[model samples]
Target: MDNTDTPSSARQSLLDATEALIYAGGINATGMDAIVKASGVARKTIYRHFATKDALVAQALRERDARWMRWFSEETCRAEPGPARLLASFDALSSWFATPGFRGCAFINAAGETGDPADPIRIVAREHKASLRAFLLQLAIEAYIADADALAGAWLILIDGAISVALVTGDLQAARRAQAMARCLLPTFFAPTTKELP
Candidate 1:
């Protein structure tokens, strides 16, 4: 298998075109010819870079996972740390949902089309979601919230649900609604300080 990040213009173009095509259409629908035409890279060049279409798709997804996580962290971290910062996660999703050509999460869409749990697309999607959940877990821990793992897991549900709702219903307020639900659930964590003052 060829490395997609080998810092070649042809490889990068293939990666870029593959991501855009698959994201707009789907993994099953996108073809190497379309990628070649869109990227303006020759078919032989694309094959030289990526051993196969799946390899290109996998690499594109991996790169996108990194990019998406960076954007999510930056967007949510813009707010002050605490419950508000946790809630900012939803705000970040809202912003993403409103973006032009927003067609739901790349990972979710890819995984939906993939049946085999062992497929690279499925593995990439799983890893991406795990990374997202880990980020939420970190946020929960940082806020001194109890049951950080559970809260983070639930938050991941809300985030994914909101994305699905927005995509299916064209409702931009999906994230906000999920955020409201999260707010309702958050109060259980708040309580009077029990630790003795130093």
Candidate 2:
């Protein structure tokens, strides 16, 4: 019942190890022994930190969500908040794709493996995607794009699709292709007001 190590370090150690192992080997494949080995925390210590494996996994994912969203926001929203920032999302994605051990999206991967929509992990996955969609919508709204909702939805699809395709095909250009496709949609969806006409 005693996690022995300081609460913060013990909990964070489990979270760190669980995130890496789950992302690399998946929920079913990554066992407690592996986590114990990677974390160097005892079994009882893990139980003291988390009641169950699912609890540990869910917490790890929540931490991962915070970390991933922060990094993604810094990458995509660092520039001016308009069309440029919106388009820069794809560029950010491209850079991420090029990174070592890039495995597409953790949320999507987790969701695909989850059967129960009511599961905690599934909820976290949905939360992650919703955050992304909301960010895209905000950008579209700021850019005064017509039908911001629809454009944001489309961008989410394109982004997720590009990630999946890139993971499967090992083609880093998938992000660029998706971006090009997104670019074409801009003029198509954009409606200029008569007052703004040249």
Candidate 3:
């Protein structure tokens, strides 16, 4: 069923609009007026839900993280819990990074706009990263890694590091390297094969 007719749906539209703009541009660059205009929702409505621009930015990051996590769960489950799904996630990230006008990860990019470490936006950003690390650890375990936590941490560092490097260097070859490294490091956890007597 279409949800656009509901208040919750309208609120979601506002969140989606804000996220798209803020992610494509920067949180500092996207203002309340622009969000209201693009979302076709009244400024009063936005203010009604979110008291200030900072609140909106924080909510937008949370919503963005939720949506991303949902998509990641789906994509990472498309194949068996091993190299195939692992590589698929990298492919998805690469494609997302290559999307038109993709500035960077909104949470990561937005953290710079705030001075306070305890700012809601920065908290949301940190939570998003932590959630990703946890998810990767779970995935690594299912892939049968001997030390799933360490392996997942390494892989996540590689994945996020690649994104940062790609955004800075304007090169995506790092994604390929990360994928290769993951494949190389993963097979060590598989159970050893037993020989069949002739």
Model 2 agreement with the true structure over 75-175: per-residue lDDT tens digits: 99877877778888999999999999898888898888889999988999999989989988988888777889998999999999999999989999999
Model 1, stretches more than 4 Å misplaced? 1-7, 190-198
State the local distance difference test value for candidate 1: 0.89
Arranged by TM-score with the best first, the candidates are 2, 1, 3
Q: Specify the highest-lDDT model's number.
A: 1
Cα lDDT over the full model 2: 0.86
- Show the colliding residue pairs in model 1: none
Candidate 2, clashing residue pairs? none
Lowest summed lDDT over 10 consecutive residues: which window, candidate 1? 189-198
lDDT of 3 by residue, 71-133 (tens): 877867776776577666677677767767756666779887888999999999999989888
Residue 149, candidate 2: C-alpha displacement in angstroms: 1.2
Please give the TM-score that candidate 1 achieves against the real structure. 0.92
Q: Candidate 3: which pairs clash?
A: none
